[model samples]
Target: MTAISTALPAMSRRDEIWHGLRDTFPMMVGALPFGVIFGTLATAQGLSPLQVMSMSLFVFSGSAQFIAVGLVTSSALWVIWAATFIINLRHLLYAANLVNHVRHLPQYWRFPLAAMLTDETFAVMELRYRQRGSEGYAHWYYLASCIGMWLNWNFWTLVGLVVGQSFPDLKSLGLEFAMVATFIGIVIPGLKTKPLWAAAITAGLVATLLHHLPYQSGLMLGALAGVGIGLVLDLRRKKLEASVYE
Candidate 1:
């Protein structure tokens, strides 16, 4: 208890809020290029500025928005939905893990936090929860982090729209790779365990092999297969550990 107490910083609410934004700044930076790329692609896809801006404001999922941009004309509606849903399945795990920490909060607080929650927010918030054990004004930190990311994304999306409109071929500049780079940074660090390894590797292989499929169905299939395989392996591992303990 003493060690844990000493390890967790005792900071003011203002400090926590600042730390939330300050700590997440790198993640924000990583995502900036992605935001610009998305805005460029969406506008290039013939979506109006209002539509592009609304998507950023409301959807806010970089991965999903990118999928929508690529598939809006080529893929069916159901395919887009499935692709986004599969990509976002990780958020379910994120929410489940963080639920206990915020269970004491009112519905109003939990609702917005849930809505604004992203990979970056979850990464930082999980670390914060671990360090502080959910004490102090941690949710304020969460809120501020969300606010910072949300604003960053929307702002860049607008910039992309403006620049892409002027250039009209910004998407052809081989810039979409920024999303790939950002995602690699976000995902690679989390593949410490076996299940995560299986999921990522399997997803990549399957998505690659099935890339010829129409409507970007490969992504949905690969993601589903990877999640399913990872879950099975995780469950088996847990059962084996339990039996050993027993």
Candidate 2:
């Protein structure tokens, strides 16, 4: 009985990791074109293949990387840095939502997991934690999702870099549209609540109207607006529930 009890936890952890990998497969597929496009565009923008791969390996942010590559020539170093920083502000919210669940984890586990956290991985982690509760080795499951995405991004980046060297016109191939479809897939499934729909519609309209803004500031503005709208609505709903109970 003692031996069985000891082994079961280990077995369960393995299962959690497996499930994490399995669930993130669709997101990985959605990210495939974006990774390849980033690699190709970075190289075409005069970044060496090593620099391109290094960005994917270390930074691991698809949108920020794309923006960086796009502005590498036209913008100053500080401007590029600031643009990427603004683009990644959403990760702050992602990390905040997860802090309660991961606060107890050791530094070693927390640091790498935090570094590897991305939109898709965060989505997978949030869904799993909602359904399974973060009781056991849930961090291992999060780690699995992160590692799968890291490997996939690197592999496709390499393929794109190599192929871009030969084709030179790879960007015109329309592969980037895959990323749009993928983002829609990620967002649509999560819009089950009224707050979500309001946020999405608000952001979409705001972004569309401000699309002419430089450095994609419109995107950031729209995101902030959406978040603000969602928060206010959520708080009001909570207050109404409290008053009803009273």
Candidate 3:
């Protein structure tokens, strides 16, 4: 109903779609190598081509899928569940803004967009909404951006599968760090809140302290502790706000 790209003078629906794809380029740069690394390494870790590709298509979370692949054999299923859940908790923050943007749309529109939503999509979409203001067919931009990323991730994963089957040692390329870089780009800007910064620092510290633990259980414990602490602080802030309002 409203033009989300109000800032951009005038543009057609197709143009908006292309603009969404164009704007997501920088994010795709970071995701490209990460997807390849997952494709290459996941199979080596005992996942079949079907399973790996299914993860990209269905799970569709770069960090969480990587973690799942890494833990698929060594850790228990519960561990994989807990770890990926913690890793994806960051999406909650992203979803808050996302829901507000798409709240006006129908279920058909919102469901897929929310399902395929990622850190990169959220960041770019947030910027678009804030800078441009959603007034027209901005949902097309949102949808196009998401589809662009989804296709990019799936394509690279297939390439990794094809190439990794032949080479078997792409991990040695040190290309995995690209995702880490992408995460930093995602997190640093969002650390505007005290709870987020505190949780991040605490999670790292606790995980590092417990790094020597068996099955890497320390990482999960540390993450739990960080989440606990963050929730406490957030609740306290909410009460204070409510008291002030009263």
Candidate 4:
């Protein structure tokens, strides 16, 4: 085992903080336009500023917030809850990513990381840990990334609120594309893995085939199918590995 450093000298802390700040900038830039759009839309949909900011702060998930706004407009609490549950289901994936990297950390550390986790932070942490093999203050690095994201998310959300009042054409600003592109970029790379590829394709096909299902239930079904297929593939992989050793 690599020995832990006895003390994090001054230079190391500075470097970690620097790395954190540098990595955070791009995400902040990307969030600005999207935040503006969400803010404007919430206003258009008749949500009070208090409601918009409340959702932004407490829910802290854009997709879920968007879905919630739609349901609130329609006054369908049950559907809103159901859709929010489905859309935010990706949190499970984020948790899985955290498990891979920080599961070895103390329970106290791991639990907090899990609570603060977001898709971007999870992706960044996973990428860095995979590349660097989790040495040299990795926990701090992950914390830095989360701090950056949390700040960006809240900051741009506030910007959105202010801009939403001033600019009625926020949707026309086309900021939503950034989020679409980000998710696509993250997802496309996973296709390199056979099991993941199979799961993704199967899920997409199932979702499309069931698109006509009532009340968009197919989305939940697709997620379930994808997760099930992935788990089965993982079991087969483990069985094969055991056979080789036996």
Best candidate, TM-score-wise? Answer: 2
Clashing pairs in 2: none
Error of 2 at 184 (Å): 1.3
TM-score of each: 0.78, 0.90, 0.76, 0.78
- Candidate order by TM-score, decreasing, is 2, 1, 4, 3
> Model 4, 1-246: lDDT tens per residue?
866543343236567666755765665566656666777788878888888888777677777877776677675788888777777777887687567667679988886677667777776776666655565577777777777776677777777777778887778857789986776777787676677887888888888888888556687688779878988997898899999999
Ranking by lDDT: 2, 1, 3, 4
**Across residues 1-246, which tens digit of lDDT does each residue of candidate 2 receive?**
243423233337888889889999998998888888887888899999889999999999998999899889888999989888878888998999888889989999999999999999998988877766676888889999999999999999998899888888888878888878877988898898888889999998898899899767888899888988988998898999999999
Tens digits of per-residue lDDT, candidate 3, 136-239, equal 77889998999999999999999998889999988799997887798788778867788878888888899999998855667677877888888888899999
lDDT for residue 98 in candidate 1, whole number 0-100? 98
Badly placed stretches (over 4 Å) of model 2 are 1-11
lDDT of 3 at 127: 81
Task: Please report, in order, the local distance difference test score of every candidate based on alpha carbons.
Answer: 0.87, 0.88, 0.86, 0.73
**1 against 3, candidate with superior TM-score:** 1
Best by lDDT: 2
